[model samples]
Target chain A: MTDRPALSRVRVVLVQASHPGNIGAAARAMKTMGLSSLWLVQPKSFPDAEASARASGATDVLEAAQVVSTLTEALQGVTLAAALTSRRRELSLPAQWSREAAQTLASRAEHGEEVALVFGNETYGLSNEDLRVCQLPVMIPANPAYSSLNLGAAVQVMSYEISMALATPAALPVYGEPLATVDEVEALMAHIERATTATGFFNPANPKRLMPRLRRMFGRIALERDEVNILRGMLNFFERPLPGSAASTIAAPTRDDGKA
Target chain B: MTDRPALSRVRVVLVQASHPGNIGAAARAMKTMGLSSLWLVQPKSFPDAEASARASGATDVLEAAQVVSTLTEALQGVTLAAALTSRRRELSLPAQWSREAAQTLASRAEHGEEVALVFGNETYGLSNEDLRVCQLPVMIPANPAYSSLNLGAAVQVMSYEISMALATPAALPVYGEPLATVDEVEALMAHIERATTATGFFNPANPKRLMPRLRRMFGRIALERDEVNILRGMLNFFERPLPGSAASTIAAPTRDDGKA
Candidate 1:
């Protein structure tokens, strides 16, 4: 009713679904829980008669689905990709449980991030090829004896977890308000790089060696926006053209100058 | 490692919850969605043998459950209340949809308003007394032919709706700002109320009528503390005598000149 929970950034895609019916069911499941942008990666029976019928109330989602040849193409512009899987692939990293994955996505989404949670084909789940493309693997826990989860069921649980994680919490603020933006943090890092270069903290002779250490330190802080600004402001003090003295002998380029 | 989403301001109260196991499962669902506060109005078998096992890892919510005597007592100070029912109610007024009720509760919750979502005993959705107390009723659309939802399932869906309604579309401010606090907002609201009361917008004689309208308007907006302070500053434009001072002044002259 309210634009499916304002899902402007979060995208959910099911790849290579074997049963068109499952795809339809997945769409309906997603629709019910405030998710709708479904992507199909060469679905075997998608865009078919059965899928539309099974989708029941979510025919729009089925008809509007994008059919892509490869998983990479499906994941274009997706900064974080969580591949939904039933079992840990032989070659894959440790699978994140639903709660863990949802929290991860929520934390990132909290920062105004665009994320895609990818679900694989019905029978095989995520293939090794698909696993290679995903940033993290998400495994929904089910009865071990009957570990085979249907595509719609998997989607339901994952969608439920995501919705739960994104629920507006009632108590104290969880994420700091105005948490640092990606650009702000990057700008702070750039300033840190510049200041380090000026102070010979990172030897221009060996910039790589000096830079990584500084990167590690910044990583440790997980700097929020206010913290980033504080650091950048301190750097800016040095970055400022030191008061009237020691003007550059060379002609200085002005604002909007055609300098590279 | 991360904080779960905060619970909604709409507290979930189970009235005379019959089964300990069902109660435990309900607690688990609430906890999973970051809904920590649980109120049991005269629970029959809470803290029973099967509860802990059924809770399946959300013991904290169960441990913290607040048990009160009557439904009214449980709903004390609640600005709004909603009862979840599957069966048709014998209300004089027409029924409200779940979505409408959810939005109403959600908006109130946004403003830190105290609200309670009442769920009745497992056998019955809600009692006649429970229905009488609730300001709104929520009906979950299900298969009419076979619409028997388990208590936990009902809670999960209701919580899901509440959570999703609060889901946001705004981009969080990135690194470079201080987070707002509740105290600062309280101060701002106090200032505005005083000024508005003097401005006659909040009339003393017809307060109940005007106040709810004003409250609804306020409830619709997500007011950060900084914004609240700005609003207070705007309200301070009126030269309003302090209510405490005015009351004391009005009382003092009469005391000095009285028969005593």
Candidate 2:
């Protein structure tokens, strides 16, 4: 096939998929649509026969698929990632229909921006925690009566749509600053967690929906690298106390990593 | 689920399919798209364990499928049958890209015309004979280098397209006399065969490409019932010996069915 730079930049992340055959079939689906990058987050089995048999001629994709332990690791350098969620969640970014989401992902990928399409397990689907870090929510418009498409079929449809969108990619508005990488977003979330705990605004012991809400808010922002830096700086100031002030008299909690 | 008259009118026909598992997967695909009618033409095996296992929750569709011995039998009562052919053939009608065909099928179904989407065996897609009878040809646009979609995947994509089209049907021009049913077209072809043989215009003993060429020609016309009647009437008149002409003394070939 001709070089599809956009397809090459898009990674398919299967998170905690239990069925090895499904993983293999998904590999085949990806390859058939000209996508090669495959990231498996905590798959139950990697080189099973069932998966290879299902993959048919696409064993190459399975053989080269990257196995990671976490969705975060799977999304390492991805600038834009969409969580494939069929159900409505309490606080996810408004889900874009598969075609629209494919267009968005394809547009970003056309500009050489690394993007990911994340799929959850066959049974449980993506946990709220898993949906939290992804910048977008994507849903396939299937029959409401029986919308449960097999994992492989879902991958096939999404990949096919993305390939179609790439053929006539819609121009996306370029941001002044590059979007924050997955790692940058993770780091900012970690910093916010620390700052919130230190300031006693959020109690770690009673951490209920606070972190999830914050994650959803940040995910919706599609934070740029500069925005991440500015946010982290503000968080640092909030965590630090003024010298000779009453707040300074009280010692801050110490952590094993040395940052208070 | 609420009634989707268009979906109800559509039937998925698998012809001489070899894989029982693919049969089951195709059932699941149909059900997910709200399509229930399934017609199997000379399947290698049915009611098999592998097929049921692959069907998951869609065993209902498999259990209700109508099994027949030939594509013609499967397409009975179908006003519009599209032969899903990925490969180009010499005498087949121009294949419509899948989405466009779906809109065509959906529009007819919305008007209460029964339609069928026919797929052939995995190894040797639709035979020339099978392609000749269907009114339309449909092709799913996949990566050209690896357009070999698995039987189940192909069904899934086609079903998906039809379902999507049904949701937003395009206004189609209504025609008089309604389209000829598959059986009506088959009868017309049989009459033409006899008429051509009687007039010494076509030698079935050296059939080569005559029948297929005629089938493609008639298929492209989307013959109306009245048109089929008129054509068959003309053939009947031509087949009859000219009054007091020397041709009356010549004997027409006898057949077991005794049409002559």
Candidate 3:
């Protein structure tokens, strides 16, 4: 406990931030709220004197920040990416309110997942292109009349939400046993698709557009580690073994041939 | 709820110790752990040169500490007092393991009963006379082999225990409405005693013996504010209603009626 920390397993990425000073201020806010992993994506100006000066005692965050060229580069191995969006996007990604986003992101972080909360430029929020790139646009609710929150305030709100969640461990239900990890989730979807291609969940001729909807529901639950294992265990039971089909396997079922 | 502290209330009392510095540290612990209204009975020194310095940023607590000449004086007006003992005590009224004692005292504190937790002197714990004054001798379980904790640490443990009991009352019963406050408890006790004395459940001439035992039983449940009001209402129905019969009155009851 003495080690306390700069919060681990999560990173804050600000994209195309116009001011170096805002970067410093953002760093200060993150440190105050016990978050240190910061990522700068294609900042207009960083490593500037003004930005570092405003950072105050949060020089550690600035020194450790990873400046990347693109948002995709900022993400790579990230399991969950939440884009900060000011306006409504046309794409049908799930729009999570603040508390929902923070809790979901934090739960992922707890189980050693790389969760990236990506912020857009100061002048304009995540571009529609960036929003499309994100898994979800995590919205910050404000007075609709004037809902522009300063960059630092946004970081603080997210930090506060996550901190509260961590402090109260038993807030959420234990949800069966373990939640499915990204890999397990992918495997489960692949198995489901392979098994029922004739009756596709995502039909191509007149695509039903059902898989994305399923993803949204599962994502909302903020699945935990054990819960994932339980789910995968259940899914694996229904999954075709090895060759994916009983007939295709060495120990293939003769029932289909016998019926024919 | 905001204006007045709950009826079953917590009265945190610090004890005499070699160093005056720990008094402030104890106060800080009490404040953060959500226990306030400190009582200091015969500290080695008060308003000491080093106490405030060691208190860190918690000066308000040190400023509010009540310096009493004796433990009895501190216990006076206190209906339920728990003498926090690190080990065991010579004169024990009822044995209170930390959780038990904390719930009992915190319930009384909230109900507006004069509840108190008395810590001991630094080097030597509470005196036999001091222990005798407490209705319950609360022993905080630490590492039995290496259970030597500083006065501040003792206070912190007691405070944390009280907080746990108050924060979530799972130990009491399934989802209670809420715990009563000190005022509510006092009112209920007064009303019950009034009706009991009239109906001869308690002998008006000498109410002492039955009253203490009744208080003991009531202190155990950790009743919520509403529960206290309910009990008080029942008592009020049995007894004659007076200006103070509501039990919502904030004033401490006079006339001990301890002779019974």
Question: All candidates' lDDT scores?
Answer: 0.61, 0.80, 0.61
Count of clashes, each model: 11, 0, 47
lDDT of 2 at A159: 88
Per-residue alpha-carbon lDDT of model 1 for B27-66, expressed as tens digits? 7666555566788988897787677765666777789888
Q: Best-fitting candidate, measured by lDDT?
A: 2
Cα RMSD for candidate 3? Answer: 27.9
| Model 2: colliding residue pairs | none
Which ranges of candidate 1 are over 4 A from the true structure?
A1-260, B1-8, B92-94, B169-260
Q: Per-prediction TM-score, please?
A: 0.39, 0.78, 0.38
lDDT of 3 by residue, B32-126 (tens): 55555777877778898778865655667688777888888777788988877766644356586776787887677677778888888866888
Name the candidate that leads on TM-score: 2
How many collisions between residues are there in candidate 3?
47
Off by over 4 Å in 3: A1-6, A172-260, B1-260
| Superposition error at A101 for model 3 (Å) | 2.5
Give one digit per residue, the lDDT tens place, for model 2 in B13-94.
9998899989998999899899999999999998799899989989999999999998999988899999898766664666
The docking category that best describes candidate 1 is incorrect
For candidate 2, lDDT tens digit of each residue in A1-260? 35787889999999989999898789878887889899999999887999998888888889999998999999998999999988788867888988799999999999999999999999899988889889999987677877888888888888888887876432222224477999999999898778566545557899866667556546745666766775565455444443333333333333333772
Worst 10 residues of 1 chain B by lDDT: B169-178
